[model samples]
Target: MKEVIATHSLDEVGKHPDFGSAQATLRWMLIYMVEETAGHVGDLDTRREVLDSEKG
Candidate 1:
């Protein structure tokens, strides 16, 4: 992926039919993924706290 990105330009991002403009679209996709992962992590932490409290 790094090599591919190195060879590709930001301008070439959304040129293909399925995905759209690469630069803008990929940026949003990455942001979404990060947010989603954070949410999952928060949920996991909450669950851990609850379980720990139950052990007290």
Candidate 2:
């Protein structure tokens, strides 16, 4: 991801045919990736907390 970012401009646009012809810039893609990853991490942390409490 870092390499791709370094090679392309942030304003570079790409087609997301799999997503019904949607288009997004490199900046938007990066922001989406970060947000999605953070959400997943938060979900995992919550699950862990629940399991740990049950164990105690």
The most accurate candidate by lDDT is: 2
Local distance difference test, each candidate? 0.66, 0.86
Q: Compose the digit string of candidate 2's lDDT tens values, residues 1-56.
A: 77999999999987665786666899999999999999999888889889887431
Every model's TM-score: 0.57, 0.78
Residue clash pairs of candidate 2: none
C-alpha RMSD between model 1 and the true structure? 4.5
* Model 2: how far residue 42 lies from native, Å: 0.5
Pairs in steric clash, model 1: 13-21, 13-22, 14-20, 14-21, 14-22
Report the error of model 2 at residue 28, Å.
0.4
